[model samples]
Target: MMASALLAGSALALSACVASLAVGAAGMAARGVAGTPTNNEQAHPAAATDCSTRASHYGKVSIIDVEQRSPSKIVVWGTADDGKQRRSFECSYGTKITGFKLRPIASPR
Candidate 1:
């Protein structure tokens, strides 16, 4: 019957979706097991898409762009809280290459 056919079709579609999700999850797990950064930190070392990361590090700075120029160096450019136009940062990923927090800098330039 048409109703039975429709039910079978729906079941097939659902199975496909579930299988796709499982594959995606497996791929992600493989990447993690292979020692890849899940947070996209490997690519964008100093990138901050929102204010929280900026605020946590530099306090109320509006982060616009972040680029990793070198393995140890990153440049963060954005408008500051006091409305400074060219406020920026050049930071190190820390002693062990763990970029958890921005270290103290003597100057911005």
Candidate 2:
């Protein structure tokens, strides 16, 4: 019980941190301080890139593992449509993503 709680808390913290980092990086770019591409720009390329173009597009995630708020949701992190790093989760039945295999992002072939 305690272990599950800890795991859930850790997951939540990590998710929040990832979100904050992405947002912060975007904010910095918008200011043109570093002349770096903003998150929106990064997201655009990610969207264009096909998931199959990269072998590491899919990964395993524990179905029974996740933060309390999204305990039943399975999270997967990888490149998105814009070719930028992104994370998404789906319900267990939406796909076998939380178990046997994870599906890849579809591309406009």
Candidate 3:
């Protein structure tokens, strides 16, 4: 009987531990701490606007990706009207905007 009681106690403790772990994981996910961006998390507004304005000179620019390189710098990748040509724009807050055209590498025939 004592052995049975011990087994039941152990099972309850294990289950409680697992339940707490599951709850903690769920809470982390809900709080966007699981390495995933929530809906509210997006590229900096000023960075996006600056990139768009600078890239507009190329043509009707379509932004592909926006990445924050640092607290004050953001890099935006995009394609112009042709879509074949890719470009990258780097915007540093309170500084100049730099743009670069990404050239496609020619494959060996």
Top-TM-score structure, candidate number: 3
Question: Compared with the true structure, what per-residue lDDT tens digits does model 3 show for residues 1-109?
Answer: 9999999999999999999999999998877854543232244666567767776776677777777665445676665544444444444432346555544434347
**lDDT (Cα, 0-100) at 58 in candidate 1:** 48
What TM-score quantifies how close candidate 1 is to the native fold? 0.34
Preferred candidate (TM-score higher): 1 or 3: 3
Residue range 1-109, candidate 1, lDDT tens digits: 9999999999999999999999999999997888732333464543444323544444556555666655544445554343333234433332222343333333456
Measured on C-alpha atoms, candidate 1 has an lDDT of 0.53
User: Ranking under TM-score, best-scoring first?
Assistant: 3, 1, 2
User: For candidate 2, what is the TM-score?
Assistant: 0.29
User: lDDT of all predictions, in order shown?
Assistant: 0.53, 0.41, 0.62
Between prediction 2 and prediction 3, the one with superior lDDT is 3
lDDT of 3 at 105: 33
lDDT for predicted candidate 2 compared with the true structure: 0.41
